[model samples]
Target: MFTTRPEIAGTFGCVSSTHWIASQVGMAVLERGGNAFDAAAAAGFTLQVAEPHLNGPLGDCPIIVHDAATGAQRVICGQGVAPAALTVEHVRGSLGLELIPGTGLLPAMVPGAFDAWATLLRDGGTWTLGEVLEFAIGYAARGIHYVPRICATVQTMRPLFEAEWPTSAALWLRDGGPQPNRLWANPALADTYRRVVREAEAAGSDRVAQIDAARRAWYGGFVAEAIGRFVAENEVMDASGERHRGVLTAQDMANWRAPVEAPVFLDYGNTRILKCGTWSQGPAMLQTLALLRGFDLGALDPMGERFVHLVVEAMKLAFADREAFYGDPDHVAVPLQTLLSDGYTDARRALIGEEASLEFRPGSPDGIAPRTDYAAAVERARAAHEAAGSGEPTVSRLGASGGDTCHVDVVDRWGNMVSATPSGGWLQSSPAIPELGFCLGTRGQMFWLDETLPNGLRPGRRPRTTLSPAMALRDGVPWMAFGTPGGEQQDQWQPIMLLRMLHHGFNTQQAIDAPAFHTEHWVSSFWPRGARPGKVVLEGRYDLGVAKALQARGHLVEMGGDWTEGRLCAIRREADGQILAGANPRGMQGYAVGR
Candidate 1:
């Protein structure tokens, strides 16, 4: 089988990401003697500037890291928490909204990406703040070629920006008018980074002190002040068809910081998959793996109808559990142990049959009833689809305000590895803060308004975010670091890549380039949250025979464009000190580099 591109190989270091600029920046850091952490931080910051429409500095990130020195793996919880004043009562009673709007100040959470990256650099990296930020600063100041998707997104939101978000219009539009397919510059954002660097440099000559100083400047100083004022004074129109002011304050930004915690691990065969805690949809992947463990996956054709149907059926069950049980562990006690137990997965696996099950069924873990309204969720999805037709592609949806996130995977010569998914704060999500050159993320939209649910909107609770990143280790050694940028499809696309690699011995690029499919049978995490019962969206590259067979099994089949399913990237560290990397060619943006 031919891949779109060659799988890069090297003995030094490797980097892969959604954008070529970010991948190049990571490679440059590696070439400069920095490790994987340093390269990942640099690439993560550069992604904010290179793919601003897909992600920004104010977004959230959930990163998985493996250190060779200690043979320890940890997850940095970069997903921001809801503001202190944001609660179900406040949103439903005071704001008079049924669901959190998908595109405005009301849905903004505390910005976590900047602080999280800084934390990683401070604790694990071997570079200065100024060194890592230099690439992003240069790009924002000198300007970069505007991608056509970005231009089209801006054009779609031009009317909304002109009427609602003038600050965004001023930053993205030229002379208060549309400018497409030209080199675009964000001087304000460049100045913002420069100011942070200047503050860090002034703090001291020590690298750690300088990093701490940069953190202060972001969380306690000018950055926080500007964001607080903007959210407090501005009222912007969101997905609710009305304008509303946000509840986030400067206090929220100051009070919150990203935390380092242990990853939830699942031992599958000889490989152990690591994901973030229940706060993300990561464990859903673990549950799927658990269910599939009962079957001989290698015996089935990798792209056959039986394989697709079995995987889709298992995914539906896991996602159903996601809607019912997953939430912030600090607020709700997730029956994680029971959910991942072999006994439970065996019972769940029994539900799989020859025909597709259109019903949403979440298991009773530990004999506790699940907390979700399947019929209501289905009705909401149907109403939303009727009102807004099927949403656009990843890059064009919401006028590019908020659709997908961005991913970076890095592995250095010394065996240090990091897989980080940086997302949120899209150019179309909210009005850009005039002085900051970025907008707030609308991640809070993932929270349900009903207080009775486990994932109900609450003060200080992390939203059950869809931003899931994955890392796996073989025999207690870091083997692979991989992830994608789809909101809900993050975990769905991962299993295919893993199966191909484990069963058929596919290389990184071959695994990523293989045809993929996902079921939208559960409620979506975005605005107008809806579900498509028995729906299976497959890439057109898949064999037509497989599609027809799936349809015969009662799947509401839909064909996506060839190579339009995922934006996955991966890097692996071999035992012989060699590094391998791969990136998706679907969007014509992702690239992988090594040498």
Candidate 2:
């Protein structure tokens, strides 16, 4: 399944996966004069068939698209919404239980990825849902060309497959064990895909109609009905918001919808930065860049001690603001202008020592407006839960476990581009709805049970999302499109990679191939497992003297082996009409194909 480099002399497209067939489908879109967005949609659809462990057709997507024809930039908020059945009381009730993280059971919301696909087609894409989805259906019905990555992941999670969850077990295992490499397609999944196709076709023969029909089938059509029957048979929560188990009901599915909002754009010096709405940390990336702009960053070598130090220090200041002010900005008055103003960045930058690092602390959320009623509501909910008798903790206060996600970046020959991070959840087998073919995302786990917080559960409220797909336009031309699939790491990686390209003058491949460093709890907003409690993980390739220098400055430094960091894919549109694309060599991919 290894991809050989494709020619990029003229038209081009690149897709990365453990499966080769998926790449070809995307390449076909490019060969047929489809724009980057169209090709991305096709590739994304194909992955559902080729890489089941990573995404389901029903997973979530966060997409950033740049149209060269008009210099218009677009973002599709593919993140799911809280189910109608998800009440403040329900979240409060689950707070202390292991299931509070919204894993392995009825989820807080339905998957919104299919809705994104439908949106893309309705807005800019040319292909029909049938055309884009055919390859996925084909791979699902026929057989997938398997590889080592799939085999490894399947083997790792084998015990979950042996459980009584019929759909999860049947899909991942054969003969009561994990499925091995090179096996033919699973008949159950094949049947599911076939039914999906039939349902869509029945819904409407045209692309838009078919897509809408498919989504209906996923939520309220045959699949949801089947799910209802299963839930009824099992005595789980029914369509009504009553308790067979606890949270989630058929009403939630009927009420689900994705929001379309304008991206928050910031002007830092001459550069224009785009961030996800207040529900995500994308704004902090802008704030960090603003802080760094106030410094003398050009004085140091790109990879030298001074450069990394400045970036990390600036991020700490920005992230402190993140913990304090970032949430649903509509609900919480995030003093974003003040936070990004010259005054704040300058003050934060001045606090940094020239040679020594300092412990990170979150900045005050002082001038920002707080939701007093929301806070009181949470307290009331917590009291009610306490009054009723609570169960063990469901929400893992520990950071979210790595579930599954994939990213793609495409810069067309004409400077059109698309960057997207599509992700899935990690709820175990017993929790997933069989007809959906994927687990519900654990995104709601990001919300706090504290009613005082703006991010607490509310009707029609969006959770704080971690994904931010991005595209860069320079001189009115699409210059760069890039994004990654790391949850919290998503915030840290964007600036580091973008700075490498803009300031260090590293080409796409060089930036991606270069070693990366990440700070743990002491530096990063979200720290990963096994990281020494107060240390940052630096690549071993970094000079020991640099680490010593950092440690001397009061920083705790940890070393990282290969590939424990992050994955990135990027494409740059050169002054000429050529597109230069590079995946991360540190990852399982890093090649551009064109012809």
Per residue, candidate 2 scores C-alpha lDDT tens digits across 1-595 of 1222322344454543223455467677878887776777887776666666566655678777776677788778887766665666664564333123433444444567777766775577777666777777677667776655666655555543443345555666556433456744655555665776688788656777777777777677666565555544552221112233434445556566556667776665446766677777788788778878876665677667777777777776676566556677656666777777777667777876665444445554445543322233334345534733664222221112246567776666666677777766443323345655554455665565554566666645566677777777675556677777666677677788788777766776666656677654322222111112235677777788888887776667887875556577777766666666666545453345555
Clash pairs, candidate 1, are 381-530, 401-428
Q: Output the worst ten-in-a-row residue range by lDDT, candidate 2.
A: 523-532
How much lDDT does each candidate structure score?
Answer: 0.89, 0.61
Per-model TM-score, in order, reads 0.97, 0.84
Worst 10 residues of 1 by lDDT: 392-401
Best by lDDT: 1
**Clash counts for all predictions:** 2, 22
Maximum-TM-score candidate: 1
Q: For candidate 1, what is the total of clashing residue pairs?
A: 2
Judge candidate 2 at residue 297 and give its lDDT: 61
For candidate 1, give the lDDT.
Answer: 0.89
